[model samples]
Target: MDAHRKQRQAQHPSLTITDMYNVLEKLRSGEALSAKEQKTHEQGLVSILLQLHTELDAAVAAAYGWPANLPEEEILERLVALNKERAAEEARGLVRWLRPEYQNPQGTQQTEIGLSTKTKVAKATAKETLAWPKTLSEQAQAVQRALQLHERPATAEDLLYQFKPVAKPQQGQRLQQIDSLLQTLHGLGLLRKTELEQYVK
Candidate 1:
């Protein structure tokens, strides 16, 4: 089973467990599937893979101290709650570092540095939240700042959520504006666009 999973992952590195879950749900609902999804279904792999997906989800949920069969909405709610709890703990200088060796290499000294860094990051995040730039150039710089802070490639929509528009445009117009800003940054060689259409510095 592990070998099969590794093989599948190698073949489709971008295929996520959530994608498989959605495909299975669509199948159960008799909804029309996309061409790729239809092909997977025709290959008779959906049911087989879905069983593995379920087992994986159950194991993950158990590790998180959650029920094995939580609905997606409930899972999201729990995640948000946990995130808030962690944030509060962090504010109180209690950090649960995922990688102590890498994040705090110099022992107690590094831990102090990490806490100080987290405090600065928290302040920066609070200041940036819902505070959109007024000019296009400022917005471009803001995007760069956001990318650096996240330390990962982001979709335009992901970056869009980081700020509130100074003047609310229609949804479609707002998306176009964001795309244009990304293109401007790309042309200026300030950012790079991935094959997945995400932007990074």
Candidate 2:
């Protein structure tokens, strides 16, 4: 039975609140995490965040004693808003930027949400294929260092300074790749985004 449980946990990482908190602390401390561990952490964190957002889902909400009937969007909004408040109140970190991907189109693209930005957002180049940080781990390391130096969660905007020199993204490509890389790192658990934004590990 123990072996079976271990196997199951190996297949599906635990999603308990304690597990979530541990991962958060690990990321907050900028500990080194393997790609696989990072992925697991990302999945667990997202599950916890989404679970908390599913206010109407009894099974998920029951854990937090959150009332049902609140919409997912509202819950998500509340989480992001609260993080912003906490960051400002405690100097914990900055929020992620959720760009309006659909502003030019008529709902053709997903609306940017739950992302973060820095005090100033650097723009991606208008034209360029891409370049820089050859591997995910390399990128992740950069962000982690940035977080430690900054002593706060890092936004893509903030990470730009840390990675751009290494990437040497030419004038044409500019900040495009860094932005996408930040998202990738967030997805891989090398980095994290609060409800709607990405922050460095």
Residue 184 of model 2: what lDDT? 50
Q: Cα deviation of 150 in candidate 1 (Å)?
A: 37
> What is the number of residue pairs that collide in model 1?
0
After superposing candidate 2, which stretches have Cα over 4 Å from the reference?
1-136, 163-174
Candidate number of the best TM-score: 1
lDDT of 1 by residue, 1-201 (tens): 345545656677765555666778997688999997775554435677666556555434533445677888999998888788779887998766443445656554322112224222122353465456564444544655665555678877776667665455565666666676666556544466788998865
Task: For residues 1-201, write the lDDT of model 2, one tens digit per residue.
Answer: 234334435667654445545655566567877775567576564344443333224322322223455677988986688577656744643323333232323434331221233311223332322234454434433434454455466666665554435535473353554565555545433344665574634
Q: In candidate 2, residue 114 scores what lDDT?
A: 19
Candidates in order: C-alpha RMSD to true structure: 18.6, 16.1
Q: How does candidate 2 fare on TM-score?
A: 0.27
